[model samples]
Target chain A: MTKNPIVNGKLVCVALNDSEQFNAMQAEFAEAPYKGAPTQPVLYFKPHNTWSTDGAVVEWAEGADSMVVGASLAVVFGKECCRVSQAEALDYVEGYTLVHDFSLVEQNYYRPDIKGKCLDTTAPIGAEVVSIADPQALTVITSVNGTVVNETPVSQLVRGVAELISTISYIMTLQPGDVIAVGFPGQRAPVAKGDNVSSVIDGVTKLNNVLGN
Target chain B: MKHARVLFNGSTLDVTVEDSFSETGQLKSKADGQLINEADVTWLSPIAEPGTIFALGLNYADHAAELAFAPPTEPLVFLKGANTLTGHKENSYRPDNIEFQHYECELVAVIGKEGKNISREDAMDYISGYTVCNDFAIRDYLENYYRPNLRVKSRDSLCPIGPWLIDKDDVGDISDLKLTTHVNGELTQEGTTADIIFDLPFLVEYLSKIMTLKPGDMIATGTPKGLKDMQPGDTVVCEIEKVGALVTNIVSEQEFYGDKY
Candidate 1:
């Protein structure tokens, strides 16, 4: 059995990196609280406690009726990267994997969704990391109980894989083994207790987890 | 007992701080009992490998009112990455062209035991020790999305924690401890831990119910009112009544990054 690729690193996630999601929320971004679309990447951290390997059982947070599951391509860094250019960003990547990013349903993005997103075992990573020639051309498919519920193309990302590493590395250094989940599509699949959730990065890897409690 | 991690003689060592020390004498290595000079060694955050860093925003009623907002009914919490942490006597950069950057003196509770669904009554049992941190914020990067966004709160070297970790038993009665911040030898911010809207036990219980709390996880229990703008060349000392004082220097981006900026 292959080891979980993100066991030793911190998981940093990008929000609204999907072009479809960014465009869908464009009008709301101009309204009262936001006043404008994000000029830079929206980032959040999935701490170690939230990390789990494939085939794990994830428990629901208290009173949580359902969860929004997002399928994403995980970029594993191989080098200490800081302020690298987009052209050289991919050179620092170790490989790619799949991740099922789970969160409770939230209405607004005004505050950091800690309670909704940082639940234990909510982020299940693929068993192994595999090299891919072009991460931008890949597609992610999420399923519930063996049935496909949502599909998104990596081409729809507002900032491609290389650009995300470049932009984020300029703000904070990315050490070896660090994982970045290059955002998720606007549409996501909802999973309930006792359901099997699986996310796959087309031909690369698959992550499976069972929702419980 | 107070514990610390420091870089002495080109290697990291776990050391314990003695109750009595001269101005120059500081730490004693646990391995060899060798006395080390404070100025000769580089200080590091007490916890060598921290798990998750949870920070609170607007957890103080006075601070919420200072920012012209009502106190949150629920805890306004956020997660910070490890890159933001710097050790005592370190330099936290003041990004160029930013109008407002401030220091937040906060009490940090370090979790010692792994727990899920931890109750408030048992929260005290989970804490291993206490430390002080200066949670700095660059107000210019504030955005509505994730209001206290990572850009503003989690910038590299933005959070400076530790002088040492004091065992909880040594620092009794956390309910009304005094928290203060001094900038350039002038006392500028002051408040009591009693002003914190959501106390430590409440935070531990609330967060653990959402996710498991692992050993080395730290919770920065928010700051109070009296925030003042900090500029380059300012030396800020954040001290809690029983906890140790953590000192940090504010330097310009050029000074912090040197030729890289």
Candidate 2:
């Protein structure tokens, strides 16, 4: 099956923003030889194998208590971009969409836990891509079993869409159709087997999926 | 002079060019041996559809010393997303408020055949050709997590590799070549393949033992020590002796939205 038609031959990049909440979550590492927040965004790639669509049943790995939801918004590139100025970066976006970045609760924050983050069917992105007037002001509401769990404002994002495009462009060219997940902020909610999870990003898209035992 | 993938007729074609890399070139199609117009297309990364880009960290003894890390007995391998790969003449960016963003000049080995449990003796046979790569790093993003975090090394378009791919047979003894980097007109980084701690064949053999090495996979051998920050409008050239000169320009800070929270 195709992962996402628009994402074929395109990259799916995840940004590990050194946000205030991320720093707070990492306070456990504040002992001697403390390594603080990274000066910039740490990035990782979720191979196409991790991609899933709405209504797909993602198999929960055996023995894991719960999977965490990576509630995020992705910016789709509408045109080829390189070294784009932040002022004009937003112009490169085709639209915004929601993603259910599902993964096992991560214990290691320094290096990407390949087993936790790289499992198949870990990422479920919304199909309908929609243009947004202001991505920075949007709200993402995540619910488990019809109960509201977490609501985050796009403003909590350390870097907005424009800055993300420009900053990422500095390193590589952003091609049309490439999707950059702005990042999942704070500690995410725990999802378990047989749970119906939904992440709603108003005006953009909503992603629904079921975790299978 | 050798093999390259150029944009032609709206599609990227694997072609062997007849002109020297320094001059405007022509395409000799590998599929049908038809010569097509090279002027209408753009240059894409030599390994256009690569699986995983395995890069080395501090693979050179002196470079390790420069960074204050002990030389690793084994390869310091890291995976860069496909977004990091850009073609020659493409730009590498240095963002605002970043203290140090530098370029690393290294030799790239493109795997031609797939193999697992590959031995050191058969490693060279799996390599199709060699190319030059500029593994640019934004040091400000350095976090202890994955020592050289993706933000520091794997940012979009940070790795500019290729002008042309010189067949492995064309590039003499890998260890004998000189690898140098020039920012604009000034020579800054100077090193030799001789300094590479885990040499080409060993790197391939080592990597294959862990995972299958597929065709079109790239193993970027570590860069030599000399590194310096680049500015906007500066042209960064990575020249591998007997290989090809991979040229890239450094542009000014691309603006980002919002006050960095």
Candidate 3:
């Protein structure tokens, strides 16, 4: 078995306690969200106020509003790419994994854009990462609470995975530590606490976890 | 809950979340290096505020076909503001007379570290975790351009996000994750992570090139097929596999503001 590292950083803040594991990507404070993936590779940053750790827990604010669960595929950057080109983009990838991108939404509240997107314990990523791949021969499956919610072929994506990497390289310089989350299927529904969710890419790896409060 | 800062230390980024930096942590000194504690944090964005927001256009094969366009050759990404995130359990109000709000269940991305142009090789190192979001768009205002702008997509509170963040390492191969959307307990949208036109590694590398992805930035990955309109009083739940779900309610203009007057 290959070594599967969580963050591979030095400073980790989990559950209001604990110490470092692997720090997050640098430049986060200075970066901003894209103005659209290609036209203007923008930058955004979330304060450290956004991290949550180990078996992260989310809530509906105890009936203050509504809630649901989501599952996704994420990529862990092996290295960095700064204004790199398509030709050199492939070399920077570390590989792929899973992430439980969770969030809390109040009906009409929207501010501190980073606050909602950067909530503690709002991000849950998987540990299974394959060291290498050609981008074409991968398979992916999405499930919730033991139910097969979505099934797709890598060949169906609107953009072949590799090209996006190259395009992004042209916009921003890739760094040693970064994450790329592939899009998710559109047919699944929300799961509450006690719901088990799992996903598996046929020739790749599987992401399995349970949703909880 | 703690207040933390994810920033570049020389060339690396570290996440420092204090328990209460916002309301309690006394800024001992005026220097940026004030004795900050993970506690007393007042400046933290509740997992809903993304440093930068990323959205997709017609990534859903079905939605694409409905729009009569070939499946995109690449992911169609767009941007929004951290100011657009709504509370996870609160209610979202539709603009006056706008077509009923439509909810697109999507896989939301959260960066753990900072990366300039992140290569797929070392991409994993940058991630802290992931979450889900209801990429709410005001269909009535969305115009001809495939990319919805202020008229349709960027409405305040149109984006519903929430509850937790899972470390990227804890959840494996995300490509196959699932997404589910519920409108008042009725299943409305069913999708999977497998359909993502741009996989995670590529997204990071591609996105990083376009912009510098900082810790806490939120990416609302493309939504799947089955896009539907939401109405007042309808609760929308966006559930993704592994990642917890985000729930939000829909309200009418009259109900949006309960007598702030």
Candidate 4:
């Protein structure tokens, strides 16, 4: 059973080496943490096991005790980039979507290499993966069961989407449909069984789901 | 009954089971043509610029001895990237000028969450399960460079993974699983997970302190002895005791000539 994740019309993989995300992250580290270079981009890998179709229905895994939710914008890439200029980064983008990368916070975050990402039903994506947009004008809003919790404008990113792509390109090759999940705004408050969590981006669309037992 | 990840028509799948695991015959038949077996097709690598491909060095005492390194005090840890991985049953393509490329067969644990400051008492709960891994490498991918780069490790196809992920819990004691490597039917490397210097839980606690590990992440536990220099046309086979075996071949590196590096 291959986990082929698709959002809009693109396959979900990565355009690695378009190290723009890491570059922006370093720039962010300079001020945010009052630190020096980050040395490395917050690089990540999504094996075939991690993908969920946009808006795919996700159920709690067997023996699962609880649940959690997150609201964020998933920046989707359309073309491959490997050391492209920041200005050219947007050209590789296919579009954007309101992606909900759900996980079990109760699962230890300390073992991300083992537990957090591989839970049988780890990612619960949203439907209506919107294509092409003005990211500058977008605002992401997160709510737990409909009441707003955290909100931020896309422009506030420590590293804009373009800058991050350039940073990542320097390390590895970025393939088409590679997604740049911008960092969480404030905190991704956890959701429990019977709780509903959702999000909406001014231009990216909206996603909603209820934690099931 | 549940969704399991697989590969179909060149893409890995997160498939929902129309049946059950107890129904092995039913599972295989239901997934026969749909689920491509590791030995049946060319396996491409699953990671690209992976934030970090973590490895627990000297897991097997036999491997530690062959390399002339003393057994580690704790898990001997190191990091690799998207370049280190190749697909299961893939062509372990090598550049013409390169020598000393080798294969290490081992178990892999896939992370399902962002782990940090986790304790051993709670570690097992984090791992999804175990799977097969062949950690192939070019002994000297570094040309005197202090740091490793994708250019040396990141060949189009390097690490080959998967027959299917066997749930870690079902694997019983992870530290003692058996594995053997055969080059064209000549058994070379053999060992067990029991030799690992760093067990899974401690590794989780150790890594989370340095960096944030995310879901879908992979950890190559380490390999056993039987290390050998692979040549073109050589068939590299890795067999895990109860788990399935993965067999890949060495291919010619015709594409490297055009690269800028």
Candidate 5:
């Protein structure tokens, strides 16, 4: 399948706050919104230049050996959707796909460092989108060199598809082709160069990529 | 006069010069000088392709004080996506289950010429024109992950920019203009560009050093204090003296999301 070329499309990413796992990490913030269980979804972005598709190869800069891989599910919008209710959110979704949110793991999680996240070919999404009514029932698996490194149930996502669509639409409109990554439930360890990285959402779509220079 | 892109005949977007504003606005075709009825068309962000939106945080002393942060000696730069860019008169969404979703009326500097290492004096020349914008913030989406998180700042249509672009030559002395934001006819925020810690030319010069400023790239300098939350159906009028007024409609998540189910 021919991969979708990202022509300056918006790639929105969310943060996972699995209560038992994320609580302690979130405790460091004493601020109003950050202190409590996130009243709103924590979000970030991977710009168009960072977008790639299956069979793509991502190169690491000099002195940079390994990068973090966030294997997750992406909700692709069928049409323009805005301020949609959770009950009707899924109606606007076209289908489900796979995404590898590549980043250079950094100790500072306080703020998003673009250099660490937004790199050319860093985000490789599945070329094909599969229709799925219930996304949370699926499992997302990541492998490096054919060895399973991380795997989690989509149900573990802090905010499900409907809620994520409803919450995000409150600010802007999501058009056809715009993708919102539901997020990975756990930590994404680092994978070094010359490794084959693959992310698969059981029975939905699988993505393969090679880490290079 | 200012340039604007309006939805002509429902689907076609054509450039027009906003001639004047009244209950029923007036516009002239930029290509053929034909008159257009403002009500007959929809508004779009004056600059269609705003490449790499570079925003500033705490560039104003009053805003820094309001947020309980120390005034930074240097500009805090962050990137926002183009999806957040919506035209004037458009509605911005405020999700349910959160407080502190506020409006930040800002002066937008549109880059006209592409340049790197732009000098402070020549920086002003690189700017094409000025426009008004409401940098709506969903503080509920605020996280330590980023000062202006994508959820908080870059949500679709969160940044309502432009009724039209006021040519740089039309607006003299960019540093002394007055910025006022009215919510439902009540003036909630009022400040002068003079209060800005970093001036426009300095910002362009500062940013151009880090990255190239291309034509149509917008620098949303920063916002002032007097921040407050808005509700659904509320009308936000953001006006920059000498520049035009940019009106935005606010809708609740439920209302905007529609009851399709």
Candidate 6:
């Protein structure tokens, strides 16, 4: 197994960045607790302890029967970015990699999902970061135990790569090598213990991990 | 002993603070026996490179009630990026468009050991020291999705931590410490660590159960009630008993970054 490409940086993940996911939760968002749709990007952090290399076994939280797993195209920043306009946002991109974002099934969106998303080894990234011509043109496919589960196009994002970096950097500076997972699209594939999950961004990178323990 | 990192003579230096020296205090450089007044040096966050920064929200019953919500059964933990961290005596920008920006006086526990699934009984042994931080929140930017989103809490320089890290041994009982916030030298927010719904040991065990608690990782325990809106030029001091007082100056965006922002 290769070393995780992300060594000394934070993994900032945007929730509900997928258009389908946003639309699906739009009704609930308008109800009490939410009141309205999110004006700014819903952000959360997957700390370093959660980071693992591809092919590593991710242990499930005690008593957790299943988990939601999805593949995201993660943009790695090459420079310290702060307050850059959307037009120039891609210039700071170092390259891209695939990240397996695993989370315990969560129904609440009003509070930060720390316990659900921040479990150790929950996030596994591809070994390499390869430069891409157009991030939005890519398609990510997730396979569970050799069966195709979900295929998502990067263009289906509510906030594209550049816009996410632009808006996030406007609030907090992203250091060199920092990652922004553009977010998974549609519904994620549910995986049980011992299931081998693979996510591939053809010609870019592939991350494969198995659920265990 | 209180450990600190400061900028002196155009270089960063590790120093041991001597609180008994004078009113302004003094620090002795570890490299050499150079003693310098605290006012002459720029204080950096005590931990040079902090790992994951876990911040609790509404961990106090009074604070939970103030927001008109019931005290959370589980700790409302949120992660903060390194960009949000400034140092003692630093300026935290309060955006001109925002109406209510408040300061949260928190007792920050610095993790000294790496562990996972650490039991509450052995949790305190993993702590290296304690510090203080002002977790500034811009109420205007708060959205429901991930309520208290990064925009509202993790803005650049929004979290000011340190002055120094007082070793856990130096501070006797972690609980029962007084946490006070004074804005412009007037006492505004005051509470004791005894009021912390999820105390340090409980938080350590709770967080470590989900993820590995690494050395340099910090947990900013939630503040109590009495949150008051801070304006530009307001000098907010968040002090915890035994741990040092973290002072932050609230500056407007225009003043903090000028037209660059």
Runs of candidate 3 exceeding 4 Å displacement:
A1-213, B1-45, B144-146, B259-261
DockQ, candidate 6, comes to: 0.83
lDDT of 2: 0.77
Q: Model 1, A1-213: lDDT tens per residue?
A: 123556565788888888987999999999978999999888888788778889988767679777888879999988888778999999999999987788898667889998888987788888898899899999998889999997888888898999999988877878898899998877778888888988887767888888877
lDDT of 6 at B184: 97
Colliding pairs, model 5: A60-A213, A83-B257, A84-B257, A111-B145, A170-B93, A172-B156
lDDT of 4 by residue, A64-117 (tens): 565555555666767766666788877777777765555555321111233443
Error of 4 at B5 (Å): 4.7
Could you give candidate 2's per-residue lDDT for residues B139-194 as a string of tens digits?
A: 87677765676667777667888987888998768987898899887899888888
lDDT tens per residue, model 6, B108-156: 9999998988999999899999999889999999888787788888888
lDDT of each structure?
A: 0.88, 0.77, 0.54, 0.58, 0.78, 0.88
Off by over 4 Å in 1: A1-5, B22-24
Q: List, for all models, the DockQ compared with the true complex.
A: 0.76, 0.20, 0.01, 0.05, 0.28, 0.83
Query: What DockQ does candidate 5 score?
Result: 0.28
Q: lDDT at B164 for candidate 1?
A: 90
Comparing 5 with 6 on lDDT, the higher-scoring candidate is 6
Query: What lDDT score is found at residue B71 in candidate 3?
Result: 86
Per-residue alpha-carbon lDDT of candidate 3 for residues B1-261, written as tens digits (9 for 90 to 100): 222222222221123333343476342322354564423332222463356567777776767776577887866666654435664576677756655567888877688887767898877777777767777776554432223543355544667665346556656678888888888898988888787777777778876654457777666777877767877878888888877667787887567655520
Better of 1 and 2 by TM-score: 1
User: Which of the CAPRI classes, incorrect, acceptable, medium or high, describes model 2?
Assistant: incorrect
Judging by DockQ, tell me the better candidate of 4 and 6.
6
What's model 6's lDDT at A10? Answer: 81
Q: Give the clashing residue pairs of candidate 6, or none.
A: none
Q: Candidate 4 — which residues are off by over 4 angstroms?
A: A1-78, A81-172, A176-213, B1-52, B71-76, B143-152, B255-261
Q: Comparing to the true complex, what docking class would candidate 1 get? A: medium
Q: Encode model 3's per-residue lDDT on A1-213: one tens digit a residue.
A: 111245332111111000110012123222433121222111222222333332444332233243443444455667755344566666777877665544444121111223233444444556656765565566567677677766655454444446556644432334444554544433234666766666677646665555455
